[model samples]
Target chain A: MSAEEWEKVLWKTQSYPDNHIPARYFLASLRKNPNFRPYTYWPLVLASCAITQHLATIYIFLAVFVRLKECSLDPRILVWITVACFIGGYLAWELLNCSRSDTARRNANGTKTLKSSILVFLALMALSPVLKTLTAATSSDSIWALSAFLFMLNALLADYSPAKLGGQVRERLTSVLSMNAAISSSVVLGSRLSDGLAVFALILFSVQAFALFPMLRQRLQATLTIFQALLTLLLSLLSICLTASLSATVSCIYAATLVAVTFVAPGILVWAQKYKNEIRGPWDVAVPKVN
Target chain B: MDPLSIAMITDFFHPNVGGVENHIFMLSANLLRKGHKVIVITHSHDPDRVGIRWMLPSLKVYYLPYPTIASSATLPNYFTFLPYFRTIILREHITLIHAHASLSPLGQEGILHAHLMGVRTVFTDHSLFGFEDAASILTNKLLEAALKNVDAVICVSHIGRENTVLRGQLFEKTDEDPSTVAVSGNVFVIPNALVADQFKPSQIPDVSQPSSKPLCVTIVVISRLAYRKGIDLLVAAAPRICSAFPNVKFVIGGTGPKLNELLQMREKHLLQDRIELLGPVRHSDVRDVLVRGSIFLNTSLTESFGIAILEAACAGLYVVSTRVGGVPEILPEDMISFANPEEDDVFRAMSEAITIVSQGKHDPWNAHKRVKGFYDWFQVAERTEKVYESVIKSDQRDLWTRIRRTMELGPFAGLIYVVILIVNCVFFLILEWSIPREDLHFVWMHWNRDYFIELSQKEARKTSFI
Candidate 1:
């Protein structure tokens, strides 16, 4: 058809149907995957490392529970190890802070972190006895169920996106919910312990695992890339070993999950890239130009 | 060509008034004029008004008592409307189901049920949706499912067609060649039309009579006061417009959630006397509202075939609209002053429009003539009829061929499509068994020859009056 023949004019009716598109003019304006961003393997693997660290934290908490049940780990030794690690972590954090250009702001942040840590430690110590009896009437079956549910919630709701890798607190409700559930499960489980010292140890361990650990991990990943990767590998291996000490079946499951998340998931994502044909064109709602 | 018994399904219709409602009503009326039987199916907004009512002798509207959930859209209970919709189809002897608006649950459901009943379906998309947001994502997915088996998809503009194709995932892909982009053959671009006779330049006062006092250049804005309409931009630019031109005023119409913000802005600027908020105007009185202003300002952030601007042009008002979505496709540069959807840009465009109107260089009567010649409902109806014809012809293909076409979407989507098809087929069979087609009575009120003669005579009288 000629250009004039294709021109849609209201005054003069044409011989062709209203919807007739000449072969040459069909989809002349279509643009496919104009803004598509392809994924790289290493970045995806790096992002999934957050999930590995989160799982390792859960593993350490469970290992502490198993040791407490067997009476194999002394509360006194646990307290001394926790205090020494806290002091060492604090010193390393301060040294890292000193490298920043804003010394005054770094010092303020250091003071705030120290003050908050001391306050949390004292609060957990004082609340241990109360927590020991708080869930006494609740059945052991219910407590175990609740703990499982909370742990699953933490795993599902955890933010695994690289956008949160900037050390900025992008705390979604899901993140807060997951953290609270993890702490509350520890408290409920701690209540089942016979001695207040054991309860105190459990609560303190949870505070460090659920709260302080994520911040340090995020900071490490943001500031030191190679060290973060090494830490992820070390944590994954330690968690696997601890799970194996608990039960062979549990260890096998943990290893399988680790492989699926870190390796299999990225492979699937890369395989699916061929189908990513998101077409954009002038027909899209114009993103309004703002001056 | 045989006249089709068509059912126009939507969640928006009379008792509610907006662009989509007006478009459906006008299109139905014009289709009826062309000797087609048209019935509208919409969710009832008013409790007192629930059953069928005749809007015209031929145009019957059935307001089903389905509770509206949000934004006048019915609750999207997938299969709840099937039996009732099936009953209506049988009673109306509907050969074609023409659904309006993608967001309407009734529209989507009607299309699904119509396809199961072996009737042709055409969906007209009236708005543009983004691909980024969660709500848009879910809506696009649902649209894709609904449109998977639809015979044809009609869009009001080329951009709208593109958006619909993308949202519906209606592109055909070849395995060997990834670069080739072929859109689905069912999509069509058909711009909305205006009732030119209703909105005529003769409604305006004679331009030859010069007034002793200079007329205040009133800029009219007629749109639902929604955030997407860019009412915030209008509110922000109002003060600047008022301060820049001494003899400038605004006449705003339509009611919505953003009314209070507009009132607050008016009070803060204390331009109560300058800006006239008409609250809402009936569709019949839109031309009256347009004639009161020298310029019509459309600060809509997005539009798909701005029918209000076309109406304004038909009523002899110079238009100033945001160059977003399909707004840029509606008019020539001389008829409208384009602006970005921002405060400064809109303010500048309004000021420029005021200057141009005041200069009296371009004749508004010419704009009216051009718009009238460009958009006529009869032409729109004829084009729409051609689409119906083509789809009805293609609907003759065997069931296996249709199923294969749907399965080509993707493996997972194909599985879902097959399941939906099976469920729909079962439900349709149950409905047929329970309510036998012989039990349903077909209404032939529109088939009367006198009605057609009277309609043509009325149309002729309207043209002669104009």
Candidate 2:
């Protein structure tokens, strides 16, 4: 038997006391590009549009607040503008729903129905008084801390770019943009009134945006275009600014903060997220498909 | 020797309650009972001795203050932990680094650092990972790199061995040396053992024969309602199973994203009367819950060792578990009914188990005996210690050079052997002919091997005296 045979090195048999070292030691046992899938540039650009719209809306809201603070404008105009925008969004959503009734039907099959959702929303709205009163027992500092914690949680769990129905590009873009707008709407409403109604509205809108919209947005992204998204972003920002300028100094500050937030936050967040997870180790629980 | 200096490294231990954590604690305690110096290294949790903690006599634990990454896994800092690890090893005179949990950074880092420091390393893969998912990919890569110089790799079950071989890519061939990477130690099937005394038939609820009244079969489910746990399967099967076995009741414990889905199932099936959704319970209370139920239901998609099912068997509850991971190997066929990780299969198996129990086809005592035979912490500790000793003995100087030469053929292959080794060695030979040998830095060995040998002999004598 050849003591220096390569097989001896491979099996490391003590029977063969050959000093010959084994080859292929650097071939570390690991999956080569296990879950890697390349991204399409259009999809990436379309996904970025949600952030763009959010920033534009924030800018508009600040501009309105600035006008109100400087020109001593009325808050009624701001409210009217908000209502008008909500109505416009609602109408647009309905139109989209009608156009894609078949797709909506498919999505709704294994999902919650509109009727059940409405009932749940109404129930939550009724319970808002209790939720508002919940913080009454606690101190303001505690509530602040709690809200901040919840916001951080929300940010962490929330899906940034959701998929579309049947991988439609247009539909996916539309849904994501709509979801972001919905989140913006919730933030504004959340900041506006401290009462039960405001709280309920914020909760409702948050669920709609974060939970439901992502699924719809994923469907929409497979269909929508970058141009349409840009147009939507521009128009929404202009409308928000036109209305927001009529509000008070506090509202203006809130508006300005939103603008400041959207512009710088995304860049900062993406940068920070890079170092968020340093998942080293072959020992990690492998994601298996239980067949 | 010298009290058998050992370090048990894991991500989830003590304060973090789960099957893996409980296993670690039990193993540590048993090792300590066997007169070994055991220390647990884990990420620091708030309000729990952040640095060093002593659980029991001769059981010293070091809680490293590291940021938790995801689900208790600490953010992996490879080189940053060198200084602390080095100091700990030196202070404790650690002879073996026995790491637990596949994904735990503490375990991975501990094993890697320990090997570099010339200490024996043994890694116990407590969980099974598939060859899919981004997390698994990264984990596998890191695990591969870390296990490069590992003394031995322990799998909980035979299936786990196959998975380790496949996903870990343990078998390969190369030009410099084409061979199956002979692990210095064996890939032993060390199943997770439970404390049989604590979990016994006496501890469980009285499962006398089917009463005159409706047969009250409480199906116990204590698992995190995650996708991996097959919570969705449980939701799909629970109602149907309950409907089929009218007298049977369900108690689902633990919490996750799938909690809502389970609740919806309960409501949809109108199983509120029969099924109880207990979100989460204290680890101490798990045995109590297991005993209350006549049958234990495990719907986990994958597992290295089904510790819960083993615990249930110890509790004398007829085990009905999904045939995933190392569950099948853990128990004899008579003790438990295995089901595929599907809703239909799980429901069917559960129904069959209920039927059999109602008919009094099997004896719970037999299960208790089998479980006791199969799973005992003392056996695990003894076997583990043997592995440690074997590895320590195998870590000779000759093996190190051979391993390094073998590893060269893996990544930076031909270029290294030809240029670095052959050419350099030739150059050195020629230079020796031209110039005189130069003085080099003389590094002293940290621990005297003779001292450890002497200590081991003394300990053997002490054991004989006892």
For candidate 1, lDDT tens digit of each residue in B1-466? 7989899999989878777888898899999878888999998776688888878645788989888889889888778899889888877788999999999989998876776666789999998887766898889888988887788889887667767877898876655688775676778777888878787764355567634233678889999998888888888888888998889999999999999999998999889999999998898898888888878999887787888988898888899998887777778778889997777888888878888888775466777788888878788888889889889788454567667866765798777766776787788888889889888876655557687799999999999999
lDDT by residue (tens digit), candidate 2, B149-251: 5677776665566566555555444455656444332455565677777776643334774243325888899998898887877877877887787788988
Error of 2 at B64 (Å): 2.4
Model 2 alpha-carbon miss at residue A282, Å: 18
The Cα RMSD across the true interface for model 1 is: 3.6
> Which CAPRI quality tier does the interface of model 2 achieve?
incorrect
DockQ (Cα-based) for each candidate: 0.26, 0.03
Give candidate 1's total backbone clashes: 1
Candidate 1: residue B25 lDDT (0-100): 88
